[model samples]
Target: MSDLSGSERRKLEKLLGMGSGYVLNFSDRTFGDFFDEYRVEIDNEQYKTGGTSKANRMRTFWTVANNHVLGRVIEGLIEYANEEQCFGDSNPSLVTNCQNIAKRLLSDQPVAELDALTAISDDYDFEIVANHVREAIDKNQPEAALDRLHTFVNKLVRITCERYNIEITVDKPLNSVFGEYVKKLREDGHLESAMTDRILRTSISVLEAFNDVRNNKSLAHDNPILNYEESLLIFNHVAASIRFIKKLEASIKTKSATALDKTKDTKNDDFIPF
Candidate 1:
């Protein structure tokens, strides 16, 4: 169910023109069409009754919809209001208010971390895997996404290992590759904090345990899946680690570039007359 507070929902309802018997410049047909675009069935029998208003349908939807669907529907309504100028000159702050609501909604989601993972790489394979993970997250089904998340982490660590020219074989496991990568980072002096080192070291075990999760407790096999709460906890932990690693890689790249520029400047200065 959506996490939106009653106050938040009321604010959205008023701002989106759903406080009346209508929604943002939409007739019943257009309203249905809009939700259909998002693959949402707003005409569900459970949300309908004799002579029900669109406002009532939306209120019921908000109560029962998952956060991800709620976010999408809210965003769509906001966009529609903007495009149609539904608020007119009555409230100059309506657009901003709607945007703030959307931001608060997203703040509770793992979207930022997912965006970070995609930002770190643009490879098609990476995007495909990330999208699969995102779909599950959006549906509030982290347990179902565990296998894809494992694949994504394995791919990410493999890419990081490749950047440092670490040898990896097809049979190498995720934790093994990650451990080697962490070792190389420490050897090269990229690891500057004792705490960071400890965290990464601990993550090696986490990923090691994750392998059993994928094989035994995820969609990778027919075994019973992990529960939703534990699955979300694992996802958050891995996502945080990925965020830290991205920052580390960016720092390393910037330093390498700066050092290379200095070496070039030194070479130019040392060049004497032929």
Candidate 2:
């Protein structure tokens, strides 16, 4: 069984209960052997546990309020169950169904909460990166996820340059793209705040480090496996960067359009109509 911290276990327990919405009843006749095998001490004879003792304890933990929370819980549970071996050899059918549920949860079914990077950008690259990276995470393939995140950031830089008409090659590294973006923002009088300046500078450093991590550890070439926390760190940072860049591009376009509109109004009377 893969190591599960206390919090993950709690989250999984909550997920299992949401499946039926009604309190899932486990008979002492069928699941008893399985529960006994796992040494789960039942709290009451009147009520037996579902998958584990804690399963019953946390059964009513979540209200069936929304599918979004339910989906997240299921995804987390499936990942946890696969790792924890809670539904091992005794229940192949259950495991199969759980796996199916996880896949369904991940498939193009509109999730409760859309991933901002993919949903906001309207870019095919963003969609690909979000889907594949999530699949990697679900499968515990951190290396693959981190590699995709690296590529995601790279594509973001390319898209930003294309959208803004910035005179930089799409092939440039993130740090270089960041520098050019800042320069353009300044020249266009769009770099307005010191806070924005600090964020960009910090983001460039983060991108550089992320790039190095992908090169050294991810599928770029095999190395020591990356842990979950490290992978999550890189993923979140890259996501934030993507969201920030997209917003920046949007802001620039809005400002440019407004200026163009004003300029056209100013020149309207100067034109001679045939």
Candidate 3:
């Protein structure tokens, strides 16, 4: 349903395969109508793609998009089936149990492979997010940026873990930060009740989602030069965000200072009117 390119489809399939590694067969059955989707190339995907289909132009894109979706579906089905049987035919209700099993099965990945994968993850996928961040910050269009905010938060959380080499944990208290934000806004005269509320809500929701995902897998303690570069990126982004928030706070305080000055001047003039 979502716009998926040929390469994006491939990555999703890979994720499903890893998540459902216990399944015996992931792709034997036909990918039904629900799974079949055509891949279309937008302008940006052009840079990521290789040369054009010089031979059999009609069939080239059709195969790339159509087949990619079908293959991904089959792979996802395999993962679903594997997840169903993951706990030795019993339901994996306890989080620890599932985590333990996943760790046992997957924790032994080669250092080089992990290094490569994390490097891949570090390359920011700025698809919808580029526009969202731009619009949100520019016109203060929170509604339009909600979807991108979700992605940005996840990216932030992951980068945090990557840089700090610490486990990411999302507890109830930390999760309530967004809720607390809305309450603060309502109590303060700084923001409008509606628009400010939406922005705060979207920002927090994205953060909560980030917290949920950041700890799903642990990174090895060691990283290559490229990994170090990724961590640097994480550091830079985090610092920038913190700086931006502080600047906004200072701007608000500046406005308050100006208001106080104006009020004092008006009162003095009123009292001394000749």
- Candidate 3 has a TM-score of 0.28
* Better structure of 1 and 2 per TM-score: 1
Candidate 3 residue 39 C-alpha distance from true site, Å: 25
Specify the highest-TM-score model's number.
1
Ranking by lDDT: 1, 2, 3
Model 2 steric clash pairs: none
Clashing residue pairs, candidate 3? none
Deviating ranges (above 4 Å) for candidate 1? 1-103, 110-112, 119-122
lDDT of 3 by residue, 80-169 (tens): 556666335433343334333333323332221112111113355743454454433333223333334445544544443343244444
Instruction: Give the count of colliding residue pairs in each prediction.
Output: 0, 0, 0
In candidate 1, residue 110 scores what lDDT?
48
- Candidate 2 stretches with Cα past 4 Å from truth are 1-114, 119-127, 134-143, 163-171, 272-274
Q: Per-candidate TM vs. native? A: 0.70, 0.57, 0.28
Evaluate candidate 3 by giving its C-alpha RMSD to the native, one decimal: 21.1
